[model samples]
Target: MDFAFTPEEERFREELHQLLLTNLPGDWAKRGLAEPIDSEERHALADLLSKQLAERKWLTMAWPEKFGGLDASYLMQYLFNEEMAYLDAPGGGGVGVTSVGPAIMMYGSEEQQRIYLPRIANADDRWAALYSEPGAGSDLASIQTRAVRDGDEYVINGLKTWVAGADRATMGWLAARTDPNGPKHRGLSTFAVPMDDPGVEIRPIENLAGERQLSEVLLHDVRVPIENRVGPENRGWYHVASTLDFERSGVASYARGKRHIEQLVDLVKENSTLSDQRQAVRYELADRWIELQVGFNVAQRIPWLQTQGISPNHEASVSKVYGSEMTQRIAGTGVRLLGMAGLLQRGTDGAPAGGAFARHYLTSAGSTIAAGTSEIQRNIIAQRGLGLPR
Candidate 1:
């Protein structure tokens, strides 16, 4: 029941913290985690920081040594993610490192592994998860995207929406239907698709925060070699499910929430006007801090379960649902504390915290929707965790 990290893990955390402080731009905090990198300079800075992290082999530390990683423990990877999230640092490798790379390791062929794993570990290419389609998001089994076999290649045609980082990705970890006659879940297959291939189009989608970080990708008659298929044909549903489990651990979300709560506390303490309502704000902040800790503890269990050779399913759902909903609650509390000023957009003259909380308030609305909806997570908890009759 010991909750403390080992000495080596603590040292690694401190080293990563110092590395981020030294490498990040001075004004990086001002931009805030809630705001997307909208300018060329910010994009350049993100690219630079990503390269620096890759050089340190911290981007994919948990992967095997043969795949250009340090073979670090899962707990170490969790610590790394927590540190990066707290700082809002770039170069954690996004889906490329977290979901796609692990999925490839578990399901990809030897040739596919050799071709893609190193590039992912080295940050040579950004990858997007092309799974959710216009017609199929929460009900992923209903996806209509098709990848029909055509001799030595597969001809793909579909529209994938809500793809984060699609505009910047060099590759796509795609899921498409390969067998229409089978059950919805059994008919799907996964593929490693080149983003630059013919008939692939990426269009940005602006969210409530006015950020185009999410995009829609259109594929029409796009041809990839049969070698690009990752898992067994007509069995991609299970592979996609596993990939999502990697994403749902929610450690980073809790860490990010912790940072935001700390900033909110500082804002309340420093502002004379906010100090007038100190008692109420103090109670709210305390509640938020406590909830964040609870969520973080829930998230930490996932890595521990992995270390024990247990695949966390319902546990991951519990973490994701709590963390994402906690985010929304924290954002709501921040806006309420800021009063009318919370409505002010970023870059405004009198906006508080550079309008970070306002931006977060808008973006947090989607926290419950992305990855899987809150309702979906609840179902997982009920059916898988509680053993409820469905």
Candidate 2:
């Protein structure tokens, strides 16, 4: 089967690259994509970049026009993500643009669609996800956070861990148990809560990467309006499942890996000297490039399948498993190839690639863990894809 993008898609890619070339802020490539933007200066710059994308309606390219999107082809959606990944664009903000917004569009009420889609579409909103609790992560159906109804509001109380971007988010989507007596998978419910509400507290978690990008979110009797509920009550499992499918299928990992592989190829070509080890280095880089191309082609196929009204669940599992693991491997190779210099932090005088590889190596560990773990992906491939029994 042919794997290359159509002429129109190629033109679209060139157009987006030009747009980023002209509009992206100075230092955006060297700093914005490389460093964590939790600081005010970085965040402001990222926001400016986000607005640039918003103005172009690239933030919601695949959504319907009623939601401020361009009603573009799904291919545009695929292309948009690929460009963002290749350019290291910071325009896509929070879970709103990536995971929650699409979920809302697919499963939310008309009022919710009216209220949130425009803000998200325009980069006027940021969202965090409060899905994993202290002990309830991979087995999300067992989440114990409780939410009870009281006069048009659901009072919430629980702890959520690994909540990425909660400190910077205006709103958050959380899963809580609404029926204590119901089955593990049946009692769950999802809602959107204002992050700045009186009862919600976010304590930042700093990792080895020296970034406070993730956090532990505590909800102490947080009150969510009945209207904030996503999908039907006690049916969040299905909504969350659909959203996860979207996350796996969005092609972010493939785009990211493809970009990093290209960077590595350039690095190999430009940096290596005529030494005895040059042949091996070239072989390594060539191997990565070949794998990435195969992955890119595989990535491109899913959106096309979706357009043809195919489910692509098993295919998404394969893509996620491959893309996320490949990302980690690519970054690991970057560090290995560059040796000590690659591990150097930014601002170090001799840090290789401006310490981009170091940050990526540290950050790559989480990519395999988040959005469901590699272990889970393997499980999915075995059971769902291969039709194996538990």
Candidate 3:
């Protein structure tokens, strides 16, 4: 099979690169892509970037032309992500455009689609995942966040922890327990809940990098309209399973990780002394590149699966587990190569890569933890893909 993009795809890539050049402020995109933004800064960047992307109709490129997207091919989507990550530009927020948007497109009602899709497209709204309770990390089915049906509303009650990007989010793609009597996995339901609802409380959790990139969200009788629900009432496991599948399929996993691999190689070349040290680092970097290439190959399978009307569940799980762990290893190796300088914090006088390596080293530990852990991915691979006994 041909791995290279066709001439038409090449033209699309050129056009997308030009769009990034013309619309994105170079310094802003560079910084935004590289570092996690503070609440105010995130809002500012979202406003500016959303407006710019909306003006060019670039924000919704993966959607159909009727929904304001350019009806771009999956290859174009992959190309756009590669270009964005290569430049260290935050091309699209993962939770919004990648995971939730597709879920909405698939499960949402026509009216719901019209309302939310444009908001997401314009960057007028931002989303955070409301999964992973304090008690339910790897075992997502054990989530106790309750959503009791009350007349036309569902009263959501429980706490969700380790929720990334919830501080600035206007909305949440929330999962809550709706059927206590059903099987653990069967009782769950997913909904789009407003983050600012009076019953919802958000408390920030600081990370090793001194950034409030995570949140503990308490939901107390937070009433969600039943219409806001996605898919069937109690089939949320399927929704989440499908969403995780989408996350696994995106090019961002490989694209973003590969950019860091390149950065690590550059750091090693610039800083390493002995030929042995350089050679060792070069070999490790090459190995990381190969792992990332595997992820890229998996990403290429998504569109074909979509066309074939398959969920891509097993493939996505494989990519997410392998790709995320690979990123952590590569980032940690970079810090080790830096020796004493690796621990330098950002805003400190004369830190390497503005202490970017330090940030990555600290945060990479959680990369495997977030979304789904390595162990969880392995479970998916064993049970779902290999048909091993659970």
Candidate 4:
């Protein structure tokens, strides 16, 4: 494979970089991308940035033109994500743009698409993925959330934890058990629940990084019209698997690691006091850079496969596992290189890199666990990618 972006793609990347350069706040680098959206100020900034990206039709560029997108190639979309991560630019659309909208496009009905896609594409509504439960994180098929049919609606009752951005979302991309007696994997269904429903409640959770970006969402008899269900009844397990594939196949994590690695390299070069330590750790730094490149190459293959009309399943898992663990390794190295100073939180006086590395070290702790656990990803790779026995 060429592994090279075409001339047009390269130009597109440059154009995107210029746009980010002009639009991103001057102090964004210091504030860093890993900072949690714990403040209303940050939320407002994110909303503003999302709107700007939506206005340019860059928020959902990979979707078809009929769905308020630019009909961009998968590679173009990957390039856009790469640039966004490298710059730590906010408002590039979150799960709504990446997984939820794409899932709706694939499995939602025509009416469903018309109702949700435009709002998602326009950044008019934020979405929270209500998939993970206290007992059903990696084993999502085991989720016990119940959605019972009630005439023309489904009454949902469940608790979803670790729901990122739930407080800010207007809608929830939900998964619930529609058939309790059937097999775990076969009895599930998906729905689009309104976050503002009377029975919906959100309780904020602060992560290790002191960010309230994660939360617990409680649904008590929350009802949605039958039209809200996505895909087929009792097939949500498969539908969500497809959505997970969409969530995992991205260059963002690798690009973020690249930025941090570059920052660490610059710190080593400029700080004369670290000259002795730098010589000792030069090979370690070199290895991280190489691993990051390898992960990027792995991720690039997913979009390439998509361009060829192939749906990458286990390949997405490969990229997710490698990229996520690679980030953890980079974060560890950053903390080691900075020593005690690395432990300082953001805004502390004299913290290195505005304490970005320290904050990242905390945030990246769950990289291997979120989306899908490393164990689950490996199982998918072994069973699906290698065609091994169950």
Candidate 5:
């Protein structure tokens, strides 16, 4: 496969870059740079960015025209995401925009598509993935969230933990056990639940950064209309798997990390007094570069695999595992390089890089666990990619 973007794709990249530069809210980026707390300010900024994305039809650029997407090439989508991440602009929560959008396009009814896709693109309907529970983390089939059908709606009851963006999400893509006696993977179903529904309760959970990055959601007989269900009943387990495949597929980014790596390199170069530290940083950063490149190559081949009607599951697992771990290492090195100053909170006066390294370190540590744990990804690589016995 060609590693080069065509001229048209290059033009598309420039167009999007220009759009971000021109229309992106200046105050939003300013507040992000100032507070950088991932708080209400960030949400306000995301709301502004989401509107801009919706206006440009960029929020659904990867979707088909029928669903309000631009039907662009994979390269264009990659460029868009890289640009957004590099600018520190909100990508509008990964699950709603990236993962569930594609799943809905594939499995949801016309009404479901029409109702949800547009809101995802334009409205501040942040979404959370309700797959894992306290009893079921890496092994998702062990999920115990139950949904029992009654008169016209299903009553959902259970707890979902470590659900990202749940504190602010307007809706959630929830997985629940619908058939308790069926096979482990065959008893589940997926539903789109309004986060503000009466029986739903959200309690924010702080991360290593001392920020509320995730949440614990409790459903106490939450009633969801049948129309909210996606795909066939008792088949939610498959839907969740499909959605995760989409999530893990987009992990690699040569360009998004490039600037940070360069910044680290330049810092090391300028501080020649710390020769040993600089050398270590250089060596580790070089390894990260290679890892990013490998991820990029694998990511590029994925489009072709999809075109040929393949799942790209194994390749995605490899990328997700390698990329997330490498990111943690890279950010960890950055924090070490900054020494005590790195541990300073974001608002500290004279903090190095305005405490960005510390933030990255904390955030990167969570990435490995979120999409899938490193050990779980390796299990997938061993079983699916290498054809080993489970």
Candidate 6:
């Protein structure tokens, strides 16, 4: 029940901070580099930082030793992530560390492990995920992308929108239907595909924030070697879903929220705000801070569950939904605090804090929808966590 970091963990956090101090661009924090976005420049900068994280073996330090890791504990990995978020560092797509690498380690061919793990651990490659389709997003069982087996390969053909960081990805983790019959989930399969294949195309999509946050991917006659399959054919639903645990767990960043809260508090304190809501807002801020702390406490429990070899399906979902919603709430509050100025985005004259909060207000519109919709997470909590009926 202890909430404190051990001395060693503290040391590791300090080490990470030192790494950021030395390796981050001189004006990195000034450039709004901490926010997640995808552009040629953003990805390239993140790629460099990721490589730096890899050199210290901190990127994938908790993985098995044979696959380019040092066999560190899960707490170390958790601490590393906490530091990254606290500093607002570029976590990139994190597809490699979060889902792709773990999926391969669990269900990939030995050859697949030998080929991909080292590059991923070393930050020599980036990966995009193609899971959601136009018709099937929240319910992945409805995926329509198809990969038909042909001789020594599978030919992939379909479209995937919102493929994060596709512009910088050298490869993609794809889920497709390999069979047209049987249960909706059973006919699917997973594959690792080259992002630059002649039959694959990636185009950028701008979010309301006016930033290229996602990409639309088109695949036609994309041939992937059978050797690239992650698990047995027609069972990709399991392989891909196994790692949703990874996605669902350990994603909330209390540090980021805490930092954001601090920023707003400092702004209000320094300026003799005009409105009486300043005092009222102070109380509201305290209540919201308490909510964020609750979310953080919930998030902490997931790491403990992980260490104990438990998944806590509902607990993770609870944290995920709460954290996503909490962030959106924080951004909304910022918009209200800034009033008309809040509406002004960056690059406009007199936009406060370079209009970061305004941009965040727009970008956060996607937060609840990304990993899983907030509503979906609640459903998970009800059914899986609370043992409610389907």
lDDT of 2 at 252: 75
Residues 303-327, model 2: lDDT tens digits = 8887887767878878888888888
Model 6, span 63-131: residue lDDT tens:
888988878776777777777776667743388888999889999989999999999998888899899
C-alpha lDDT of all candidate models, in order: 0.88, 0.81, 0.77, 0.88, 0.76, 0.81
**Stretches of candidate 4 above 4 Å error?**
none
Top-down lDDT ranking: 4, 1, 2, 6, 3, 5
Q: Give lDDT: candidate 1, residue 367.
A: 94
For model 3, the superposed segments whose C-alpha errors exceed 4 Å read: 22-34, 39-43, 91-93, 272-276
Please list the residue runs of candidate 2 whose C-alpha ends up more than 4 Å from where it truly belongs after superposition.
Answer: 30-33, 37-41, 270-274
Task: Give the residue spans of candidate 6 off by over 4 A.
Answer: 26-36, 39-41, 91-93, 250-253
Error of 4 at 147 (Å): 0.4
Model 4: per-residue Cα lDDT over 198-271, one tens digit each: 99999999888888888999999998999999998999998888767767775999999999998888877877
Model 5: how far is 353 from its true place, Å? 0.7
Query: All candidates' TM-scores?
Result: 0.97, 0.94, 0.90, 0.97, 0.92, 0.95
Q: Candidate 5, clashing residue pairs?
A: 189-236
Give RMSD to native, each candidate: 1.3, 1.9, 2.6, 1.4, 2.4, 1.8
Pairs that collide, model 2:
none
Candidate 1 wrongly placed segments (more than 4 Å): none
Better of 2 and 3 by TM-score: 2
RMSD of 1: 1.3
**Poorest 10 consecutive residues by lDDT, candidate 1:** 33-42
Superposition-based RMSD of candidate 2 using all C-alpha atoms, in angstroms: 1.9
